[model samples]
Target: MTQVGEGQEAEESAPPVMTFGAPTAGEILAERYELVEHINNDSAGRLVWRGVDVVLRRPVAVVLRYPGGDSATEMLQAAVAASRVIHPNLVGVYDAIDEDDRAYVVREWVDGQSLREQVAAEGPLDPARATAVGNAVASALAAVHATGMVHGNVHPGTAMISDEGRVVLADARTDGADSQENDVRAVGGILYFALTGHWPHHEAPLHGATAGHGRAAIPDAVRDGSGAIAAPRQVRAGVPAYLDDLTMDLLDPEIAPPSSDVLAAELARLDIPADDHFLESAGTLRFTAEPEDDRSPLAAAGGRKVAIGIAGLLAVALVGLLIGISIFGGDDKDPARKPVAQPSPTAPAVEDTTPAAAAVRKLDITDVKIIDPDSRVRDELDDADKVTDGSLDEGWDTQSYNSAKFGNFKKGMGVWIDLGAPHTVKSVQAVVSAGGATAQLFAGQGNFPHTSSGDKQLVKNYQPVGDALEQYDGTTMTFSNGFNADQKYRYLMLWITELPQKEDGSGKYKIGVQEITVQGS
Candidate 1:
């Protein structure tokens, strides 16, 4: 009888116990939605979870702050206010629940990553594409501003692009203290970051915007003594003039920020048109380089005039020849044979002699810092100098993750070198540890603080040195038209967008950097 009673008690306690203030997977919230998985944690310590609305049978994201207390008061208020306004670009709020012990806000789930992730992985977007992203955010802000509300949190981290090519702005922190002007200016910051890979405003507390020491990792347009920052064209090589003017105006405090509506209208005009399907897969806008033979209208007209002049001279010479033929004899014997011009054998062609330049000595990168864009552990890894210390056995390696796809967590990773000062680099050579890894060489002006690989635009004055790296064994990336005076750069970022398998073949992947050598004048 005692043994049978003990077995019954064990069977009764077989189910798992639910913890207070903490929700687990498959748990139902408000008895209407089921939590699927934990997505991420925001800066405010709120848990963002992927959930399903059992009643409506739709997917949702639930941002919950445990031990509700007064911590969720602000989140609840912001959700209520955002619910009042309706915009396609705005994330829809499904429901807000305040359980005294735990508070959760259920909202529409976005099927995409943040703009910060996109830029970090793919580098900067083309001018037209960057303008399109700016325009979408501006349009959304115009609506929010119209409601007498402000999107206090408007940065690359909050800007989202859907898999269907729809642009949406998420996470509006409605504190009522941040002004509409600040929101408008943030749109300019987005354009600046999109163009230069650096945040323009120093006041905005954005992730990866500040350094580990708590200083502005990326500087704004205004220089300390200089007062104002240079135009986008001055920072970047291919920025259009009109776009540069608009971005500078918004960033400059002297020039008042344009109304969200007005700014949106102007950006729309500059944006390139694309079908929804094309924009969806392309992710960024595409622009083609103009061919050398393609000329402007004025140049084409001048060429036509030169051709007409030559045709007139040829016609006159033909008429004179006809007159001479009619007056002269028509017989073949009477016609004089013309001799072709030829050079005498004694007059030898002058042979030109010019020695080709010898390759520059390998640069010393020992003083340079190694930057990782998609690092999960530490931004500046331990013993980073090993990569430049000329040691193959000991070098920089990435943190090991579960899956080959970075655990399907972050975008990608890379390593960069700041030369301390600008140099006319002719070519770059790197010895990577992993095989089948894809790397790209990017050049930029080291005018701002770049905390991580996400600082793609901070190199405000930057350009791609060459195509994505090819032939990875001590790959040599020679800048096109080597040493064209305009190619001087202080920073060189070798971003590895893809990861190769670990040497042990555990079906997991990470990257390793052995040595980096830059040959420049």
Candidate 2:
């Protein structure tokens, strides 16, 4: 990614203007796509238009560029590459065509505005919403990277939020300059922009702004006297410390950014109701440095000796520290050396000095309900309460399906739990009948009605606490370090997205939750 001024200086003193005939609103391209309305011209001089696919009878977006022979090669390549990846968070590419005069690419038409437009219209989003956006973008990038392709273009304008609250990444550029690492870092930039309403990476040009031409539509990030960009917490109030640390670490060149999948998982873990103040027991972000090469001759000789010397010193220090603790800080008394003193009966009894918050105990679940939105019969509703009945032999189970994803009939099913009152949660552990099922933990406020419509609304309202356990291999799954210690949760949901194969070789998919235990203060 080149800086704005540097990019401008590299261009010709007076660049020639290339022309491709203008397209009319009613004109049809490739005899299949009918243009509806013109959207906008991008910084790279491509025209974007909303169109209709006559054959498919659906809305589409067409991107046109001039001089199709060689100038449009990269654009066409990117479109073809993007078409191969099918993900909910990625804008679907339909077709790419090259005419003698121009080339055009048609993709899915989104009904909502871009991130840049949304931020400009309203203000910065809350921390929870900003985290959701980041998670979506990272998930899209992970899908693209898995196919061994790089999305050279990733910015606020390329990220779109539809009217139905679906976030999609669009307009990939195959310029051969951007790397997978750059795509992952751009997600951090997205978070910064969503939380602070400012773009942190000035080197990457925005959608409508050409580098070195003029100021971008979005404002640059604020910096201190030392020329260091301010963190999200510094720019805005109420940003969580863990989120702030994760955002700044992603932007820092000194710290190695996590892979797209790793970053997506971390963001998913942070996308919860108590995200504003929740802190992970371990550090928010864990970065591992490249291991040193021990094959070198110098390392084999001097490194070994140095490592031995350090180990010897550490061992001696450990012994000395233990002896000092026993002599000066030991809590037990030596009964042989000194007689023990008895307590007076008149003296008041000493109360338990342990803090209540430090202890982890099983929380009483007031109620449990089956959340099966797609099933009209509600076959398994009766056994919902059995999940907390202190028995593992009999519990709730979903109907067996031919496929892992509920036979493509619905999204998922879940068991919703309501604690008697708000409590600081420590962990949630679920014991299933078999392995290979995928599930996630969610937290929210208030319970919805037990109807189908209410179940749909419940799914929408409850935010995920951590990443889904993708194809878990064991019988027990535990979600820990995903809650805020300062915040209490009254409602929780364990949504199962994918089911495991039945053990009896029935050639069907289903899973049963034998028991669910929650530990809290």
Candidate 3:
């Protein structure tokens, strides 16, 4: 449950209890319609059901549940309030009522899979794909924001990518009425995960410019910028420099302090040259009385999103159930799900395309290019002798969390710190295992906050791709795209994963923190 603003109802520590009654399918709501299947649930523990308007025989979703006390009542009330504003991207509320100490609030059902599934199977998505996802959800955000409501919980896991390629956001204006920025921050989080195939905060923090600098540029509450970030090209090849630069720009709130709608519009504008008609805009979003017959945003098969009633969602409800790790990975013990392979030496490195800030210094180790080198990948390591036996002392920290779930050092495991105050950090660098042959950096988080860490963006001014540290271990590369002279840091955190035995030639998994140097003004 999220914390609401002044006017909204407060969250209750104890939620309501719901029991699935043996109500036969076709049972009508308040003896009105024929009940169908269960859809979803509300705060009041009411079970929503699909039903047929027995009188009219039209499809409808009905809400019925065992209610909690004040908290449950308030949640139901909030849903009723949200029912006032209707948007294409938002779920529509039908009605609410209390019966037998159970309060039920009905809403439109949506047909789609959580973004969580897509990311889990495909790993970090491409920038264009990510933008597409973000744009769809951003439209929803725009509508919610216009209504003075914030989708307090917005992320890949929460956003439903319908079969129609449209993203629908749930839990809008539910029990929480947090600040609008909370949704903005959430957008930032989802964007990070989409690109990096991981959460933002699951990884580690970078030695940033200065806490004051990060604060000065970004909103005060968002302090998840891990100092070091990876450039996008490091992960895959053929990525246009323009797309890379755009993602990096969004990472820094100061770079382009625009709203999601504004940025989304910009992306839509980019799509004009290629295919203008596909662009989503107020004109294209024609909402007719019945959304079923409409076909927009093409998908291969289950690509269309059909808005149903509250009962529809319950059929595929994943309430109160979280997988081993978040789609945007979190800081949990690595449950080495599978084995990953080490990156090949011949893997070509992409040219760094990160833009430079006139006011800051740039740190580029171009002369000392890193491909398949030994411990120290410095300018002096040009010779083969130094590459092999260069390391002085090192330690290994391998987590035996869950062997079946979290694969070897991918997106989930990394370094992290809970910041206390502000500090000035210069640079952050580390070396992860190249990886084994079985698994990949699929579970890896962006260097900043790890990929899926919601509410935890690291290195305040870095992108999820190489713009910020996006990859860890081998089979992928991650590092600070550029280090400026005047860096900022308030609190610093670090996330690291151990190189498995197969990846590093030995099982003694460990992350090498060569050094974390701090610079002060």
Candidate 4:
């Protein structure tokens, strides 16, 4: 995962001028991004460069690959598709552009080294750190796979650790050159690398993965006659047995690979409860002495009593000195100054305190109704209330259609809710129950169950609250300026524009919403 920083150009096998289409430093693209310097060339011959977004005044990484053929077309399409799915662990794509002979993708720039670099400098990492990295990458893959898409490029080069200690998987190259299984196997490679400082994949598609002899410089797993790669514990000491088995299972092709979602959950269970935002704030939690105010102080009278006890001991120790002084010089010396005691120093300072945030309660849905204006599926209309019944076993579902986009058979479908009265809404959370459902939220002061999408009442009163959430199972949306607190509404809608693939593989699709909870006053 080598990144070309400013002024650190990567070695180019082909002439720079020819590979980059003669673009020079300071050159502007699409009248927005300004190229600063060429970073490096990927195994696919894609030229990565450091650039700046003039409009946003932010740093960006631009990947450009030339001789647009099927590869260029696939790159641009994949970039556009990947941009539609957003998750915290995935790199954000800003723009994807295609010219006649070239294509470029502008994306968020990470300010840190790659996993490969991290391992190289720090040697092998502990089991906990390796599991944490695996969990992050798996989580990102789950989000990608949920959209019915594959992140064809999952390698050490794509796993990035930012300066903020955030691990994100970047550069989703869905060129159909790889499969979901390959992504799963790559996680094993990451773990093996973290524990043994080696890469097990000899045929990795990325550059710099192997030495001149066509083999990984450091081999984490050596193949046996049975074609099963040995576990990490065989090669590295101090590796936990559970982690070793998990890594071996992931690497062995004979063993079935778990889905991204399942893998993410398993790794999360094994992860240590340490902060991942060490770069954003203090790296770790620490203890400090308590402040003086934190302890109960005794009354002044109590302090005098303790001092008197100490004074009695001092008087006995000084008795011999007092007698000798009085006999030697009765009137020569003035009376010795009375002994005094000092109070204890103030207590040490206490650690800073941060207040906890208030919890958001779910608002009850007063009434739920099927708002199928076109009467697309009158059969399922009676089951609409099942969505708010607080039971996942039985909930509202759309009629199955041949295509995910409703087979172009009817207009969109949705569930409308009545709050009983106007109330300021804060957020809307939905448990989709199934994958591949694309939905959105809207608010308005409309009459109940309009007949059509172009109904006069809806057109005059309805307004969109949050943007579309594509292919999600559980999603939460906080309304923005369009649905502010001051602009309260009694009616809300959860509209479905697309449905997920059929669970039975029938080439048909349906949508299931187990629950819908609104958080507001």
Candidate 5:
């Protein structure tokens, strides 16, 4: 009955509509997540929404992409990969659902602004604050890279600062197009943006960043006529020289950026005290780039060795400064000051009595396996790598039993560790989820078979290093002094005899090993 002109007018006057299959507020995906509000479309054309998980009764951020199946494979895969890594500085991914027509990822909802937004709104942050943010990002990247995964997206937009002042890195693309080196370089870009309110376009492109000059658009790094980008210190006052050098060195493609853990350690050292003023001295910590040829052999050998080398250098510098201060700190003219005591030149040179301490370094764990002998199913044997994955949040847990003695099924289960080669073991530290669990450290030689019979044989052959930790009262158990420091051990075992009772009222007993670190040289 309606006329054609009238129908056209009604369509024009109606509110703007979302594209078909697009999600809306109050709409529930997978019947558990209820979308609260649509935040915005990300650079990759995915819709970001602030939602709530009705089952958990917690707020969550939902990223939705239309036409799922083959189109949303990358997003789904990245989400799945990211979920395996559990770190405090990383946004926790809860679930990824593929509904054929659409795919959505649910993650922890951060109640704060992105670094880019904060910098744009409040200009540049002080060097101290920027360093803290950079430290958090680097730490997150270290955890990610430990799993051989790359967080392809590391721009300011992905660096989120929560309302509680916690800095977390979010939205890992893992698209395979980027390298770990690129991820490290992007941290430099983040620092540059945080210090100068400009994105380093030449070093790393900021995803979803506009090109224009407005506040909403992230401006490119200021450069000279020679096309070289200016350092952060030149752009802003109060930026520390060391921090400037570190940032520029990271941005420079010619120089290889330090590994994520090394960078994280350096940044952690440089992180200023909360009570200290930003403009004040940054203390004795300094980061300097050394020439390739002049670098120490330990520094050239990457991993924890590099960190140790850098720390050793800093320690030496600090010792020198302390000695100088002691020698020339007081004025001789001050009569109130006490005269320093000097050893007599004629006195016999005292014999150096202190014993040389054995060097303690983190031993490389080449292989790890669960030694479960009783259970035929071997349900708890899969996550053996989690203990050494460098993440405390993810761990290998034993199955719950009615009794602490594993329901009297067998004597106990243990985790075998291979050090790859013979090394002098100084100590073995095991971080457990709970206390009151009975455990012991055992040392064995040769390969230990991964079978029920082999497990029994291992228990019989392996000699106990220390007395059994009967009802250990702390979370971390360190077996030291028990190991023969002069002797080299290649294989070790952490055998857990009793499990801790769960806090839940279920009366079930289980134990989780969060981390196992061996220190030796």
Candidate 6:
């Protein structure tokens, strides 16, 4: 998702300014305000400018557009009306001016980028972030609704989340009278975008199904309203069932997503095991779960299978979502990859493929030791170096996009070793012992010791020779070709699954290997 840092970029033809004509920063506004910088343009030719109200000497976003006819007066009236509402989540309006044959709505200037900007910079948001943000926007909507006003627009562009974790709703009912229904639907749209990293109106299944063609049901009856859209779970697999259930429930025409406070309370009920947070800590402002479909014939027949009233429809969408995920990293172990018969060797790394993903610090490991004398397996985040078995420290850091606790990940987080060639690799082999030792092997393409973020690749597991997995201790297991053994490749990943745990608040050990051995010729 995150690429090397670059300057601000706009989508398609947005031009960074939501204006009819480019107005330079510091330009005097309406003989009173001073334009600081350009923001974005709205559907109408109106542009938002961050400037200081020279008279008030306060920061404000000024919506500037040449005032024309009845439409101009009407937009001004809508602003005048919306600015009356007061709410923490809602952006407050300070003034609305109909001056010099032009209209401008003056409001508090939030010091943050829109969610859209954040997503473009960082592919998708972590789930926890999606929820917290979604809930906050929902609260903003409720506050707007409580004042007998509707936001009218709830797209990602209208929601702003400051770095401090506060949510602010921008843009309100500019239309004289569009049904309040639009505001509600917009909330749904906002939540969808926050979760999926794409707007809801695009008419596509975000990541899984084809655009405009979703696998979930749009029963003829649902076509009349919001009833037909597939459930979030069907669209994104890892999404918790409660989330799916609640999100889908909100889509019901009869059910109003309880008031924002009520909604927050409901979400709190979805605690721990009740939600996916227990499985892992995704984040507070997450949107939806990515599908867990690893398309191996088994993923087709396996994985968690659940279908309800829209059973058949959900099933199809899942198949498509799973199919897409499986193609990449759905976690299927392949036994036969390259044929035993000689095949073509893939090309080299282009020699200048820079490190694509961000990194912790560039470090060359001159030595690696998997602690074994200790007694339990621990998460990499604990000390990443299996310090329990030995001493876990010195490997803690955060890159621009990801955080790494070298020893915090399961021993199987990644495996890196020289494979010696560039041929199409078939299988991989590791002398893994469970005698309280756990290691995870992953297959991908890229330079092992020095690779680019773009080089980091993930695929299903390797196909082994025989089903050779043997468990040794509570924290360890041993195995061979139930996965593949590689011969000629660039890198390998051996993550930690078992290591010495602290017993009586004591004891430590780490399970790893001396070196990786490949099987591909």
Index of the highest-lDDT prediction: 2
Off by over 4 Å in 2: 1-17, 207-216, 275-521
Worst lDDT run of 10 residues, candidate 2, spans 1-10
Model 1, residue 31: what's the lDDT? 92
Per-model TM-score versus the true fold = 0.47, 0.52, 0.42, 0.48, 0.50, 0.42
State residue 256's C-alpha deviation in candidate 2, in Å.
0.9
Better model by TM-score, 4 or 6?
A: 4
Off-target runs (Cα >4 Å) in candidate 5 are: 1-19, 203-215, 272-521
- Weakest 10 consecutive residues, lDDT, candidate 4? 278-287
How are the candidates ranked when ordered by TM-score, highest leading? 2, 5, 4, 1, 6, 3
Error of 4 at 330 (Å): 99
Worst 10 residues of 1 by lDDT: 1-10
Tens digits of per-residue lDDT, candidate 5, 1-56, equal: 10000000011232332336787789988989999987766655567788899999
As a whole number from 0 to 100, the lDDT of residue 120 in candidate 4 is 64
- Model 2 lDDT tens row, 1-521: 11110011111332332454879899999999999987766566667788999999998888787768787787798889999999999999899999958899888887887777778779999988899999899989999999989886778878888877789988787767779998888888999999999989765445345433342568889998977899998999999876787788788776567678767756765664554323222222111223576566334323444575788899999999978765664545755443335569999988998866567799999999988764544566778989999999999988786657664334578899999899999889999999988888889997999986688678778877745666777888887646888889999999887899997887788999999999998
Per-residue lDDT over 1-521 for candidate 6, one digit per residue giving the tens place of the 0 to 100 score: 11111111112443222224555787876677788876554444466677898997888777776643444665576678768877787777787776545667777777766676576556456555666666677667666666676666555656777666677776665554454555655555555555555543434211222122121211111122543655555555466544544554455565443344344433332322324331233222111223566644333211212222256688899999977765665444654443233333774434666766433221222222222111122122233233112222223211110111112211123344444444334444344322433344443454322222112223122212222222234322222333333343344445443343333332333343323334443
RMSD, candidate 2, Å: 18.3
TM-score of predicted model 2?
A: 0.52
Best-performing candidate as measured by TM-score:
2
Over 4 Å off in model 3, which ranges?
1-16, 20-24, 39-49, 53-65, 121-126, 174-177, 201-257, 271-521
Count of backbone collisions within predicted model 2: 0
Return the candidate ranking by lDDT, descending: 2, 5, 4, 1, 6, 3
